[model samples]
Every structure is written in structure tokens, then in C-alpha cells.
Target: MSLLKVRDLSIHFQSRQGILEAVRGISFDLERGQTLGVVGESGCGKSITNLAIMGLLSDNGQVHASEVTFEGLDLLKLREKQWQKIRGKEMAMIFQDPMSALNPSFTVGYQLEETLKIHEPQLTKVDREVRCLELLKQVGIPAPESRLSSYAHELSGGMSQRVMIAMAIACKPKLLIADEPTTALDVTIQDQILRLLKELQDAYNMAMIFVTHDLGVVAKVSDNIQVMYAGEIVESAPTRELIERPQHPYTRGLLRSLPGAKETAFRAPLTSIPGIVPALNARPLGCQFHPRCDFASEKCQHQPILTELRDEASTHLLRCHHPQEEVL
Candidate 1:
């Protein structure tokens, strides 16, 4: 059975104007010990989708889902108190900004100790501290014992991010939702963090939802890839298949835009899909990506539902009125 099953999930924000649909009935699954990369440009609802799954959306945000099942339970129906028990125990989240997520006043050790207190309250103080140090060490932090006493501001960006990862994995949660965890780190540090995550995933046998805007990052970490646009999944496929033969125009554009090591002068200019993502308050009716999709047809104005684009058992799915052959 899939570790997580998200089906027909919709999220809307109640505003003065009206409802702003942020996620429009998207569906996907994450099997045990697999990483599902949710990729998109900024404001494309990648983060929101993870947040919704984690039940971390703002108070004004309302989720309407047929089901968000994790371990045979419907997460969407869980009460706040009920979900709290599951949040850091059965599942955990790694926010994008570790600095913001970690308390400015508390030491890293204290923050992690607090998480332990909440989830594993039965553990004695000494046991909790020992576990915290072990977690820090597992994440490759040197002098883990001393690092615990350091404040959030005292640690470098990379160290703080590692600490955050440690805290998320402290409970050995079966599922981890990482929201652009490496977005703010330098390229070198980013690789280290990605490697650390993969290591942890393997060691813990955990399933993960990796939310990222970088296709390169997606390629590095994902088992399966879901390319979202505006507020819906535009395409999905096994990682290699998606990268080699993207079925949606948006997905193709994302791959083409990735920076390469080729000679800059001879390389084609990175192509971007034109037009801003539609405002949530005034999202496009038919195809959310139509205004920017080069292959959009009149039929797109009627909203192209997601469908398998070919006769073969491609596994890849796309939402497009006019699909194109793979670009060389």
C-alpha cells in the first residue's frame, strides 16, 4: 500500500473578495521509502500543496479534499489536537527557512529537546538529551554536544539547516515533507543537504515529499516527479522519464531553462514561459497555464483535464489541449 495517498485535494483561501483557490483537486501518491518531487515555479502552489498535506496552511486557508490518507487514516478530517500527535511523531516537516523556523532565543539543543518533550514525553531528560546529540551527529554536525548549546544565530546557514533536519527526523517519522529545504543554501551546501536528506531517508526507511522549484534538485532526489502549475499538477512521471520526455509544455520549458555547463555564447538562451502565473483571485478558467503555453489551442479555454497523452503505457500524464512530441 502507498504510504500516503492524496486524492482530489483542493485548497482555498477565504478573502474579502472571494475564495482564492490555491490547489485545485490534485492527486498523487508516495510509496514507502520513495521521494516524490513536487516541482514548479514560484507561486505555482508547490509549497502550498505540501503545507496542505502537513495541515500547516493558514487559518484562512480551507482544504476540501476527498481524502488525504496516511496509514489508512484521513488526515484532512483530523482535529488540530489529533493531528498534533501525528505531526512530529508519524510525520514531520522541514521548512524552507531554518532560521525563521528555529527560535531566535532558544539554543538548538533546547529547541530539539522541546520537540522531544512534546513527542516523546516519556523519555527522561537525560535520554532526550542523548537522543538529541545522536540526531545532530547523524546529520553530520561536528562536536554535536557543543553545537546543541549554540543559538540559532550562532550557527552558519548550512549548520542551522542541518540542525533543522535533525529536529525533523528526531522522531524517525515515517513521512517527511521538505519544503524547498535547500533553497537558500549555496550550491555546495545545497548538495550536502540533499545528500544528508537522502542518507536519512535510506537509514530511516522514510517516504518524503520534496517540494522544490529547481528541476536540477528534483532530478537529483525524486523517484517520481509531479510538475505543478498555477494550482494544479500539470504533469507527472517517473523522474528519468519526466526529464527525458516531458509531456507538458510547462514541464518541457522547465527542463530547457535549467542552466548547463555548455559554452554560453553558443548555447540557446534559456527559454521561459511568458506571462505571470494568474492571480489566485482571478485565475484563468480553462487551462491555468494557457496564457503562457506556446501550444495552447482554443479548446484550452474549456479547461483541459489531466489525461494520459498517448497510447503507450507511458505512466506520464499531462493536462494539455495540444501535446507535442519530445523536443530534441
Candidate 2:
């Protein structure tokens, strides 16, 4: 059985103007011991999608799905009490900004133990402390013992992220959701954190959903990649395949903005996809990405549903009216 399966999952926010469909019908599966990167521009609903899966979306948001199953249980149907047992135990999320994600007043140790206290209540106080120390060490935080007593304010941004990672993995969750885990850190620290997460995933045989805006970071860690746009998945394939042979114009546009394409040797100006993502409540009549697409035509005004193509090693999915015949 797949470790996680999500099908036709959609989210909408109720507002005075109208309902804003933040996530359109989308689906994917995650196998055990694999990394799936969700990459998109800011405000493209990458974080909100995971938030819905984790049952963290605000009350104003409405989620509906044919199936959002994790280990055979439909997450869409789970209540808060049931989710309490799953969140932080079977699954955990590492937020983008650790300093804001963590509690300001609590010591790091207390926050770390809360995961165990809720899920592994049988563990004794000393055992919890021992496990917490091990987790800190596992994430490569120096002076683990001393740092346990420190507050979030005391640690640097990178250190705070390590603490967050430790807390997320304390229970050895089967699934890990990392939402821009290295967002604010320096380049050196960013590389270290990515390396650490990759090591941890391999050691634990964990399935991870890594969300980020940078293709560079996704390249470093993901085995598979999903490119999202305007609350929908525009392209998905094995990382190498997607990089070597992107089928969607949007995916091609994103790749064009990457660092290597900007070099003088390429000599070509780095071109970005024109226009902004459409507003959710005011979505375009056809393809949501039509206004910004280089190859859009009158037919593109009607949204093209996701279509799957089988490749030698993996399936590639794309949502586009003109995947093969774009003049540009």
C-alpha cells in the first residue's frame, strides 16, 4: 500500500466577495523512503496545500477531497482528537521560520518534550530527556545538553531551525513536511541544513514532502518534483526527467530563471514568465496560467485538465493546451 495517497483534494476560502479556491483538484502519492519536492513561486499555495493535509488550515478555509488517505485512513475525515494522535507522531512539519514557529517563552527542551508527552506518554521524564538529547545530537546541534535550557531567542536562525527539525523528528515520523526549511539562513547554513535533512531521511527511511520556491534547493534533495501554479499542479515528474525534459511552458519558464541560465556564457537574457498568477476568486475563464503563458491561444482560455504521459522510468503529468506546438 502507498504510505500516503491524496486524490482530488481542493481547498477554498470563504470571503465577502466570493469563495477563493486556493487549491484546485489535485492528487499525488508518496511512497515510503522517498522525497517529493513541491516547488512554486510565492503565493502559489504550496504551504496551504500541506497545511490542509496536516489539518492546520484556518476555519475560514474549507477542504474537500475524494480521498486524502495516509496509511489507509482518510485524513479528510479525521477529527481533531484523531489527528492529535497522528500529527507529531506519524507525521510532523518543519515550518519556514523557526523563530516564529516556536514559542518565545518556553525553553527548547520543554517544546521538544511536548511531542513525546502527547504521543509517547509511557516514557518517563528521564527517558524523554535522553531522547531529546539524542534528537539534538542527531540534528548536529553542538552542546545539545546546554542548549536544551536555552530559549528560541538565544539561538541563531540556523540553530533555531535545527531545533525545529529535532522536534519534528522526535517521534521518528513516517512522513515529514518541510516548508521552506532553509528560507532565511545564510548560504553555508542552508547547505548544511539540506545535508542534515537528507541524512536524516535516509537513516530513518522516511517519506518527505519538501516545499520550496527555489529549484536549486529542490535539486539538492528531491527524488521527484511537483511544479505548482495558481493553486494547481502544472507539472510533475522524476527530478532528472523534469529537469532534462520539461513538458509544460510554465516549468520551462521557471527553469529559465535559474542561476546557470543567467550566466554570460548562456549570453541570453534570463526571461521570466510574464504576468502574475490570477486571483483565486477571480480565476481566469480557461487555464489559470493562460495570461502568463508564452504559448497561450484561444483554446487555452478553456482550462486543460491534468494529463499523464508515461515515461520509461516514471509518469510525467502536465496541464497545458499546447505542450508540443508552441510557436515561441
Candidate 3:
């Protein structure tokens, strides 16, 4: 059985402007030790989808799904108390900004130990301290013992992120949800974090749902990639396959917009999509991406359902009236 399964999951929020659909019906499955990358522009619902799965959505947010299961447990059906027991132990998340995620008042050691205190209560104080040191060391923090006493503000961006990783994985979770975890770091630091995550995932044999706007980052770590537009998945396929043969117009646009995506001159202009993602309350009627899609047609006025490609063996799925046939 799959480690995680989400079927027709939708998330909505009640607002003064009325209901705002943040995530439309979307479904996907993740197997043990597999990495699924959810890629899209900001406000495309990538983060919100995972937040709903983790049961961290606000009270005003309503999640409706035919099925949202993790290890055979119905995630949508789980109450807050039930979710607390599973979070951090069975599943954990690395937020986009480590600085905000970590409390400023507490030392790094205290935060790490608190996670263990709640999840692994059997461990004695000394054991917890040992484990905290081990975690800092595992994440490649220099002088693990000394760093323990340092507060969040004392650490560099990379170090703070490393600390966040340590806490998220302290309990050896079976699944990890990384929401733009490397967005705030420098390019070099981002590379280091990505490599570290890959190593840890391999070591723990954990499944991961990596959410990011960078296609390049996703290409490196994901086994499968899902391209989401405004609140909906536009395309999905094996990482290499999708990267090389993107079918949806939005998917192709994203690739073309990447720096050095094409073999153009050194200083040539980078391609960019024309418009921004629509506001939740002002979204267009049919295909949400149609407004920005260069190849949009009259047929695009009607929404397209996610459908598998013609090849019987291929797992490529697309939701487009005019799927691109050319390679990127």
C-alpha cells in the first residue's frame, strides 16, 4: 500500500469576501522512500495542500476529501488530538523560513528536546540531551555541544535551517513535508541543504513531499513531479520525463522561464509567463491558467479534467485543452 494517498482533496476558507477555494480537488499517492515534488508559482496552493494534509490549516479552513490517508489512517478524519500524536513522530514538516519557525526565546537544545519530550517521553533527560547532540552532529552543525546553547537569532540562515531539519527528523519520522525549505538560503547553502535532505531521506528510508517554486531544485530530488497552477495540478509525471517532455502549456512555460533553460546567448533575456496567478475570489471561470497561457483557445474556456496520456504504459497526466507535443 502507498504510504500516503490523497483523493479529490479540496480546501476552502470562509472569508468576508465569501468562500475562497485555496486548493481544488487534487489527488496523488506516495510510496515508501519516494520523493514527490509539488512545484508552482507562489499562491498556487502547493503549500496549502500539504498544510491540509498535516492538519495544520486554520480553523476557518475547511478540508473536504474522499480520502486522505497516511499508513492506512484517514488523515481528514483525524481530530486535532489524534493529529498531535502523529505529527513530529510519524510525520513532520520543514517550514519555508526557519527563523520564524524556531522560537527566539528558547535555545536550540531546548527546542530539540521539547520535540522528543512530547514524542519520545520514555527517554530520560540525559538521553534526550545525547540525542539532541547527535541530531546537531548528524545535520553537520559545527561544535554541536556549543551550538545547543545558542538561540535562533545566534545561528546563520544555513545553521538555523539545519537545526530545523534536526528537530523535524529527531523522532525519525516516516514522512517529511518540506515547504520551500531552501527558499531563504543562498544558492550554495540551498545546495547543501538539498544534499543533506537526500542523504537523510536515504538513511531513514522516508517518503518526502517537497514543495517549491524552483523546477531545478525539484528536478534534483523528486522521483515524480506535479506542476500546479492556481489551486490545481496541471501536469504530473516521472521527474525526468516531465522535465524533458512537459505536456501542459503552464509546465512548458515554467521550464522556459528557468535561467539558462534554452541554448541562447549568455546575456539573453529569460522567458517569463505573462501574468500573475489569479486571486482566489477573482479566479477565471474555466482554466485558471488560460489567462497567462500563450496557446489558450476558445476550448480553454471550459475546464479540463486530469487525464492520462495516450501511451498505455506512460504515467504522464495532463489537464489541458492544448497539450504541447514538442520537447523543451
Candidate 4:
């Protein structure tokens, strides 16, 4: 069985303007030791989808699903208490901003130990300290013992992120959700973090859900990729397949927008999608991407169901009235 199964999951938030659907019905399965990358522009619901799965959505947020099973347990049916037992121990998340995620008042060691205390209560203080050092070392923090006494503010952005990664994996979770974990770092630092995550995932044999806006970054780490738009998945396929043969217009636009996508000379202009993503409350009817799609037609006024391409066994899926045949 898949390690994680989500069927027709939707998320809505209560607001003064009325309920806003942040995530429309979306379904996907994840197997053990596999990496699934969710990519899209900001506010495309990539983060919100994973937040709902982690049971971390706000009280005003409502999650409905036909099925959300994790390790054979029904996630939608789990209570806060039940989730607390499974959350950090079984699965953990690395937030976009590590500085904000870490508490300023506490030393790094205290925070790391607190996680161990909550999740691995059987460990004695000495064991917890040893594990904490090991975690910091594992994440490549220099002088793990000394860094332990430093506060969040004392660490650099890269170091802070490393600390976050350490805490998230301290319990040796079976699944890891990295929600733009490298976004706040420099390009070099981002590359380092990505390599670190890949190594850790391999070492621990953990399934991962990596959420990011950078298709290039996702291409490096994901076994499969899901491109979301306007709270819905527009395309999904094996990483290489989707990268080389993107069918959805939005996916093509994203790829074309990447720097050096066209392999032009230095200082050449980059391609960009025409318009901004629509507000949730003001989203257009039918296909949400039609407004920005260059190839949109009258038929695009109606939403397209996600359909498989090539054959019944093909893994490439697309939700488009005019799926592209030519490779971008």
C-alpha cells in the first residue's frame, strides 16, 4: 500500500468575505522512500495542502476529503490528540523560514531537547543531549556543542535552516514535508541544503513531500512532480517526463519563465506569464488558468478534468482543454 493516500481533498477558510477555497479537490498517492514535489507560484495552495495533511491548519480552516490515509490511519478522522502522537514522531515539516520558525528566546539545544523530550520521552537527559549533538552534526552544523548554546538570532540564515532540518528529523520521521525550506537561503546555500536533504532522505529511507515554486529545484530532488495552479493540480508526471514534455500551458509557462530556459546569451530577457494569479474570492469560473493562457479558447470556459495522456497506463496527467504536443 502507498505510505500516504489522499483522495479528493479540499480546504476552505472562513473569512469576512465568506468562505475561500484554498485547495480544491486533489488526490495523489505517495509510496515509501519516494519524493513528491509540489510546485507553483505563491498562493497556489501548495503549502496549504501540506498544512492540512499535517493537521496544522487554523481553526477557521475546514478540510474535507473522501479519504486521507497515512500509514493505514485515516488522517481526516484523527483528532488533535491523535495527531500530536503521530505528528513529529511519524512525520515532520520544515517551514519556509527557519528564523521565524525557531523561538528567539530559547537556545538551540533547549529547542532540540524539547522536541526529543516530547517525542522520545524514554530517552534520559544524557541520551537526549547526545542525540541533539548527533542531529546538529548530521545537518553539518559546525561545533555542534557550541552551537547548541546559541540562540536563533545568533545563527546565519543557512545555519538556522540547518538547525530546523535537524529538529524536523530528530525523531527519525518516516515522512518529511519540506515546504520551501531553501527559499530564504542564498543560491549556494540552497544547493547545499538540497544535497543535504537528498542524503538524509536516502540514509533514513524517508518519503518526502517537497513544496517549492522553483521547477528547476524540484527537478533535482523529486521522483515525481505535481504542478498546481489556482488551488488545483494542472499537471503531474515523473520528474523527467514532466520537465521534458510538459503538457499543461501553465507548466510550460513556468518552465519558460526560468532563467536561461531558452539558453540565450547573457542578459537576455526571461519569459513571464502575462497576469497574476487570481484572488481566491475573485477566481474566474471554469478553467482558472484561461485568463493567462495564450492558447485559451472558448472551450476553456469549462473546467477540464485531469486526464491521462499516451495510454491508459501512462503516468503523465494533465488538466487542459488544449494539451500541448510539442515540447517546450
Candidate 5:
């Protein structure tokens, strides 16, 4: 059975200006031991979608869905108190920035212990300490015992992230939501962390929802990919197929804009999609991505629902009026 199932999920915020639909009816599923990567630009609702799934969106945010189930349980109907029990024990999240996510005052050990105490309160103090040390070592932190006493600021960026991973997996969660866990790190560190997470996922047989704006990072880790643009999934396919045969104009634009093999800035001109993602209040009528889409025609003046790629496997889906033309 799928570990996670989110169908027709949408998220909106009550703002002073007006209601802003940050995430519009985007849905996907993750099987046990599988990773689904959500790739999009900043503000494209990737994080918002996952936040809604975790029941962590802010007070002003509201969620609506036909169904949001985890292992056959209806997650959308869960109360905050009930969600508390499920959060770390059944599903855990690793925030984008460990420095900000970890408390400044508490030692790393204390934070790790908090998760353990809440979920596995049966663990005695000494047992908790032993498990905590093992978690640190599992995430590749050397001298794990000494590091447990260290504060968040005392550890380097990479080390802090490792600590965060350790905390997320402390309960051996069935599902993990890692929201750009590799952000702000150098390329070398980023690679190491991705591989580490993959290793851990295999060892635990955990399903992961990996969120990021970087396509290269997504390509490296994801089994399947969902391409988001303007708050909706524009395209989705198995990883290899998505990379090799992207259908939507928005998806193509994103791939073309990625840095080439050099991985350095500028020699040839960089390709970028024109027009920024529309603000929630200013979202275009008809197709949300129409204004920025190169193949947009009068047909695009009407909205299109997500549909299977023409003549392709049923699993490959896109939301576009025309899928045959090359994306500008």
C-alpha cells in the first residue's frame, strides 16, 4: 500500500489584501521506500503543499482536500492534538535550515531526546542517551558523544544538518518530508547529504517527499518527479522519463534554465522563462501558467486539467493545451 496519498489538495491564506491560493489542488502519492521529488521555483507552492500535508501551515492558512490519507488513515480530519501524536512518530519533517530549526539554547542531545521522550517515553534516560548517540553516528557525525553536548551554533552547517536528520529519523518514521534539507550548503556537502539520506531511506524502508527548486538535486535522488508552476503540478513522470522527455512548456523552460555541465555561471547566455510566477491575488485567469507559457494560444485562454501525456504511458501527465511544440 502507498505510505502517503494526497488527492486534490489545495491551500489558501486569508490575507489583508485578499485570499491567496498558494497551493491549488496538487496531489501525488509515495510508496514505501520510494522518493517523490517536488521541483519548482521559489513561491511555487512546493513547501506549502508539504506543510499542509504535515499539518504545519500557519494560522492564516486553510487547507481543503478530497482526501489526504496516510496508511489508510484520513489525515485531513486529524485534530492538532491528534496530529501531535503522528508527527514525529509516524511522519517526520526536516526543515530547510537546521540552524533556525534547532533551538539556540538547547544542546543537540536535548532536542533529540525531546522527540524520543515524546514518542517513546518508555525509554529511560540512559537508553535515550544511547539511542541519541546512535542516531548521530547513523547520520555520519563523528565523535557523536562529544557532538551531543555541542550547541547548534557550535556545529558547522553540514554538521547541524546531520543533527537535524538524526532528530527526524529518531523515531524511525514511516514517512519523511525533507524540505530542501540541503539548501545553503556547498555543492560537495550537498552531494554527501543527499547520498546519506538515500542510504538512510533504504536502511529504514522509509518513503520520502523531497522538496527542492534545484532540478539537478531532484534528478539525483527522485524516483518520480512532479514539476510545479504557479501553484499546480504542470508535469509529472518517472524520473528518467521526465528528464529525457519533458512535455509542458513550463517544465522545459525550467530544465533549459538549469546550469549546464560546467555548473558555473555564464559563458553562453542563460535561458530563462519570461514573466515571474504570478502573485496569488494576481494569478491569471484560465490557465495559471498561461502568461509565462511559450505555447499558450487562444486555446490556453481556457483552463486545462491535468491529463496523461499523449501517446505516452498513463503515468506521465501534464497540464498543457499543446504538448508537441518545443518550449522556448
Candidate 6:
């Protein structure tokens, strides 16, 4: 059974510009010990989806979800006090930027200890301190005893990220939403972090939603992948299935644009879909991707419902009138 299930979730921000729909009716599931990668370009609502799931989006943002059930409990309907109990103990989030996420004034140890205290206030100071040091070591920080005493500024980018991960998993959450967890890290560091998370997930059997713009990263970590575009999922399939046989034009374009693809080198300067994403205040009348899609037809301008594309595979779904030439 799925540990976390999200169905038709929509998160909108009512701003001075207008009501911007950041996440528009997206859905996915995460099973125990599996990583579900939410992949998309910038401003495609990947982070917003994570925020909605974590219940961290601002008050200005309105969330509408058909259902957000974590372990069969309706997360959307939870009271603030109830959510507080569940937040650290059952679900935790590793945010995008560690520099901005961590407090400069407090030592990493204090923050991590506080995280545990919030959930299990019964812990003694010595116990919390010991637990904090242990968590730091588990995240692969060198000399974690000393590192815990160091402030956020005292750590390198990769080290700070590990601290953030330690803080997140302090209470051993059942599900971890890691948003661009290794975005600014070097390639080697990224691999290290990903491997660490994978190891921890296996050890704890924790489900994860790993969000990133890099398909390469998703290729390495994800058990399943959901491709988002213009606030909606354009394509979703098992990780290997999506990579080996992409069906949607957008998915195919993304695959083709990979740096090492031989066909990409032969294509016209590496084709990129033209036109900016449609304004959320005034979203296109039909398929959201139609504006940038080369295979758009008159039917595409008539609001095609996202539905099953392949009869053989129940898991793969897409929203496109004329899906690109199947590169399966």
C-alpha cells in the first residue's frame, strides 16, 4: 500500500499581480522505501507541490486537494495542532536552500535537538544532545560531535546540506520531501548526498518525494517519475519506463535535450520548445502545453483531459492531444 497519496492537489497564491495557480490539480503516490521524483523546469510548481504536502505554504496560498492521505489519514483536513504532532514525527521536509533554511544564530546541534524535543519532549537534555550527534554522524558529517557545535556559517555548502538533512530526519519521519536537496552541490557531493538519502531510506523504509529540475538526478534516484509542465503533470511513468520509452512530446523533448544524446547533437542547435509558460492569471484556453508544443492540433486547443495514454500500462498517464512520435 502507498504510504503517501496525493490526488488532484491545487495550490494557488492570490497576489497583487492576480491569482497565480502554482500547482494545478496534480496527483501522485509514494510507497514505502521508494523515491518518487517530481521533475520539471523552473517555475513549474514542483516546489509548491512539496510545500503543499508538507503544509508549509504561506497563508496567502490556498490549497485544494481531492485528497492528501498519508497512512490513510486525511492530511488536508488535519488541525494545526494535529499537524504539529505529525509534522516532525511522521513527515518532514528537506527544503531547497540550506543557507536560507538554517538559522545563522543557532548551532546546528541546538536546531536538531529542538526538532526532536518538539516531538518527544520527554527526552532529557543529555539524550537529545546524544541523539543530535548521532543523527549528524548518520548524515555523514565528519567529526559530528564538533560539527554539531558549529553554526550554519561554519559549514561548507555540502556540509550545511547534510546538517539540514540531519535536522529533517531527527525524529525519523516516515516520509521525507526533499526539494532540490543537492541543487547547488558539486557532482561528487550530489552523488554522496543522494546515496546517503537512499541508504537512510532503505534503513528506515521511509518514502520520499525527491523534487528536482535535473532529469539526470531523477534518473539515478527515482523509482517512479512525474514530469510537470505549466502547473500540471504532462507525463508520469515508472522511472525506467519513462526514461526508456517516453511517450509525451514534452518528455521526449526533455530526453532529447540531454547533453550526451547523439541525436541531440545532430538536431537543430538542440531544439527547445519556444514560447514562455502561459500566465497563470490567464492560462491558455486549452491544453496548457499547447503554446510550446510543436505537435499541437485544433483538438489540443479544446482542453484535453489528462488520461491514460497506453492501454497496456495502467500507471502511465499523459495530457496531450497529439503526443510526440513515440520514441519507445
- In order, the Cα lDDT scores of the candidates are 0.88, 0.90, 0.94, 0.93, 0.89, 0.86
Best by lDDT: 3
Each prediction's RMSD to truth:
1.6, 1.9, 1.2, 1.4, 2.0, 1.7
Clash number by candidate, in order: 1, 1, 0, 0, 0, 0
Deviating ranges (above 4 Å) for candidate 2: 262-268, 310-312, 324-328
lDDT of 3 by residue, 47-95 (tens): 9999998999989999999999999999977878999999999999999
Error of 3 at 233 (Å): 0.3
Q: On residues 73-177, what C-alpha lDDT tens digit does candidate 4 reach at each position?
A: 999988899999889889999998998999999999999999999999999999999999999999999999999999999999999999999999999898999
Can you give the TM-score per candidate against the true fold?
0.95, 0.96, 0.97, 0.96, 0.96, 0.95
- In model 4, how large is the Cα lDDT of residue 189? 97
Task: Kindly give the stretch of ten consecutive residues in candidate 1 with the minimal lDDT sum.
Answer: 258-267
Candidate 4 regions exceeding 4 Å error are 262-269, 312-314
lDDT of 1 at 142: 92
Q: Give the TM-score (vs. native) of candidate 6.
A: 0.95
Candidate 1 lDDT by residue in tens digits, 1-328: 7889988889888889898888897988889899999998788888888888888888998998888999888897889999899998899999888888889998999999988999998999999999999999999999998998999989988999999999999999999999999998999999999999999999999999999888889899999999998889999989998887777888887777667825435656877668787888888779988888888778889988888766756578888877767553
lDDT, model 6, position 322: 79
Q: Among these predicted structures, which one has the highest TM-score?
A: 3
The global Cα lDDT (0 to 1) of model 5 is 0.89
What is the Cα-based lDDT of residue 327 in candidate 3?
71
Q: Where does model 5 exceed 4 Å of error?
A: 261-266, 325-328
Q: Which stretches of candidate 6 lie over 4 Å from their true place?
A: 264-268
